[model samples]
Target: MISFELLLGVAIVAGFVGAMSGMGGGIILIPALTLVGIDIKHAIAVSILSIIATSSGSASAYARDHITNLKVGMFLEMFTIIGALVGASITIASSTRPLYIAFGAVLLGSWAALLFAGHASWHASTQDGFTRWLELEGSYPDQALGETISYKARRAYYGAPAMFGAGLIAGLLGIGAGAVKVLIHDLIMGLPPKVSTTTSNLIIGVTALAGTSAYLAAGLIDPGLAAPVVLGVVLGAFLGTRLLVKLTNKAVRRFFLVVLLVLAVEMIIRGLRG
Candidate 1:
């Protein structure tokens, strides 16, 4: 077994990357833990706890700064929660090999999206009736740009499925599913980068909580493993948030993509070996 201190150190770096990229620490933490001989599902369980920690730590500041769209997040929470429950149930019944393969595939998809779709501009030509009715629009200060940027959350109809998929991955893999969530919000819904990322962080916390109930019932969660993971991620997320404003968007995206590629390859190899 890996020492607690090593796990904590890994979690700290995971949380930093996660907070900066809007993907929760789990994407990094789970694979790292598994490499050290932790069971895949057990590593995932610990990852969920770290997600909660990073979310709670970074989300508060984002919300206070008015970067998170609360109404949008709440509306989408309905779809995500339902998806989380279903995904968690699947995780409990499924074998680990398939999960490893699935995770690798999903990470590959996320990497592709980051490479190709990350730069797409989102602008609604016309407000769809649903978008108008929900008032899915907002503005936030952009530190680098030195002005407030406004955006509209268009095409809620299409975004719901994406959110559901994100929740599925979150519960099944014990990730924040932030990459999928941000893709939907930023690419489909037309939210600004900061808003999309911050809103995703907030939503992930609640989504993780929903999945946690199922994990707890399935006897997958280990409090002994979770405690240090949570503590490290929480502290790391706080530091990440502090550094967010200073980092360039391009730099963050490049680093995030590298991390995803490494994890994706690792999972694929592990799955094939089994």
Candidate 2:
């Protein structure tokens, strides 16, 4: 049963997950809370609110690093906001089975692509000249070069679809959609890890709030679960940020993928049981 104590616990955890993934809190909180007896719709609403708080807090720190390109984030945010509203509307009216399948499929596809993709450890020495000719360069830090690295960003045009899709998924799934945003920033937009991760964080805060509004309008939001999830996630995200200094995203992403696979199977099983 949903209770004040349970709500608080989930909120704390959600905050931590947000800090860690910029958008992973919902992926963790939703299924867990639903399993405990809250309706999936209500669970999603709580997850959405927690996402806003967590993303706002964690992304603020990323902004300080300057890797979050405000220009790109603001530009893409327009589409994401619209997509989030549409997606959340659908979620309130649909079953989650389809969303679970889609989430797993995207993760599976990303895993496969990452496996075959060969990324050269290269950065553009200048942000102008050739890069300007092609409109591809962006700035980021290169640990290997021990200084700021400026590189041309390729395939920025391809990012629009991905951004739209991420927004939809976030709203529909009550998740922050950072996983897809990071993918687009890193793969499609050719952003560095810092740039991609931080920029995704910068975008999620607003995106989540937009989604939260949609859920609230539908009266699917639950203050009981939301209260604790919000509290927990904000604190958790802060802790996760500190842990980021010690871990590689590759390791973190890999582990998250495995966990998702397991959850997908579990969701499938639970559905079958019902």
Candidate 3:
């Protein structure tokens, strides 16, 4: 059994990394908690709570910066919600070993995004019919460049299904799966990196809300476990956002890859042991 203080400390670090990378705290929280002998499902549920806290805490700043695409997020939420509900139900019914393997698989799949991170440019010159109809294009001021960066969101048809898949992963693993969400936005939909990341932070809270509800009903959420984690995440994520402006994108991406490597190994080991 892990001490409450240790759990809180772990969550704080997880939240900080999550805020920096837009991966949410769950990727770190779940593997760390599980390695410490918390039940996998319980760890996942608790991690989901932290995801909610981190996302909600960071959302205001992102929104105020006009980086989040509210219209696009709202439109995609319809698919995510449905996928979340189904995924949550599946998690509740599934066995522990399978969950472990599934978690590892998800983590492994996430590595693909990292490979493309430094090379991809998301500035789009063309908008699709869905993008035009939905008005999912927008711009934000880039303080670093001292100019406004405008971009169009194309390929909404593909992005929606990708969001549904992201939501499924979130609900099943008790994670925000924000990496996948950001990939859909930046890679598939051609949203700016800043916009995709901030929008992902905004979307994670609501997606976790859907998953948390199912966990709550399934008696998987222990309030004692969730409270410290949420508190830690909220505080850490707040501080992380404060530091974000000072860091370069390269710094964040490197940190993200290091964290992902560590957690992926942990997850795979746990799955195989089971």
Better of 1 and 3 by TM-score: 3
What C-alpha lDDT do the candidate models reach, one value each? 0.82, 0.71, 0.81
For residues 238-274, what per-residue lDDT tens digits would candidate 2 score against the true structure?
7877776322467876665666567667665655554
Local accuracy of candidate 1 as per-residue lDDT tens digits, 1-274: 5789987887788777766665557877888788878899888887886777677667888899989999889888888877888898998899899889888898898788667753566554456899879988888887887998777778999888889988988998898888789889877887877788889888998999999888989999888788878888877777776788422577767877888899899999989888
Candidate 3 residue-wise lDDT at 133? 98
Q: What lDDT score is found at residue 6 in candidate 2? A: 70
TM-score of each: 0.88, 0.81, 0.89
Give the clash count for each candidate: 0, 21, 0
Residue 39 accuracy (lDDT) in model 1: 91
Ranking by lDDT: 1, 3, 2
Runs in model 3 lying further than 4 Å from the true structure: 245-259
lDDT of 3 by residue, 159-193 (tens): 99989998998999998888788879877888888
C-alpha RMSD between model 3 and the true structure: 2.5
Cα lDDT of model 3 overall? 0.81
The TM-score of predicted model 1 comes to 0.88
